[model samples]
Target: MSAPFVKEIPTLLSLIQCADSLVKNPLTKESPFSVRVAWFDDAAKTQTALLTHYPRLVKESFYTEFEDTVQAGISLLNFQPFWSIMLGVETSQSSAAAESSATMPDSSPIVIPSVAGKDSPPEKSAIR
Candidate 1:
């Protein structure tokens, strides 16, 4: 009997992890600011292409353009989750900073206007 064929799709988490690494360490051992990130369901396919094209693509200019293209593609993808995670990180960091502060405001007041005041002359602070 023939084996059933399977098709694989890379997970969004894997892509996000790779992007995180690129955003963190955007450098390769051989060159600075030179990183190439590509994904395929079949690693062999990617390996074959890399083996065939690595030499031709090993150059500063090539990496510069490659980086730009890769970054552009990453930018095109929905990175809202990544952005939200980053915002959470910032919020935590700020929370820590706020905790360190000697005085933190408990609450702030809100102003409201009444219908009676709406018909009256405007106050100096209410000038629009």
Candidate 2:
């Protein structure tokens, strides 16, 4: 959301790499590690996007605990329209498995703050 925050992407990636290394055992080939992320694109008309393809070699990782937490909070405040981004580690068989598992059900209801601004407009339509 801010310039300073955007600059921390590299650092976040490093932390995620470290976490992945800690979670994945070098001796166990079955327990490979990877990072999965979801992001919102204004043009897409969808709230999120996930990694659909795997690169020949995956090298970089991105960790965003604070960012994700903040986004989760914002989503709650904004009536859960969607989150800006979400980051998580995957130790599954493949990226597809990770993507499937990361998706949230549409029926879930997210709670928002009870207080509304005095100047805020009245609700014209009920939230489905």
* Per-candidate alpha-carbon RMSD to the true structure: 23.6, 19.3
- Candidate 1, residue 42: how far the Cα is off, in Å: 34
What tens digits encode model 1's per-residue C-alpha lDDT throughout 64-88?
4434544443455543455445445
What TM-score quantifies how close candidate 1 is to the native fold? Answer: 0.23
Q: What is the lDDT of candidate 1?
A: 0.36
lDDT of each: 0.36, 0.31
Q: Which candidate achieves the best lDDT against the true structure?
A: 1
Off by over 4 Å in 2: 1-50, 54-70, 81-128
Error of 1 at 66 (Å): 25
TM-scores for every predicted model? 0.23, 0.18
Tens-place lDDT digits, model 2, residues 1-128: 23332232233234334434433412222322231111122211111121223221123222233234334434534523333222222223333444454563344333333334779986643222
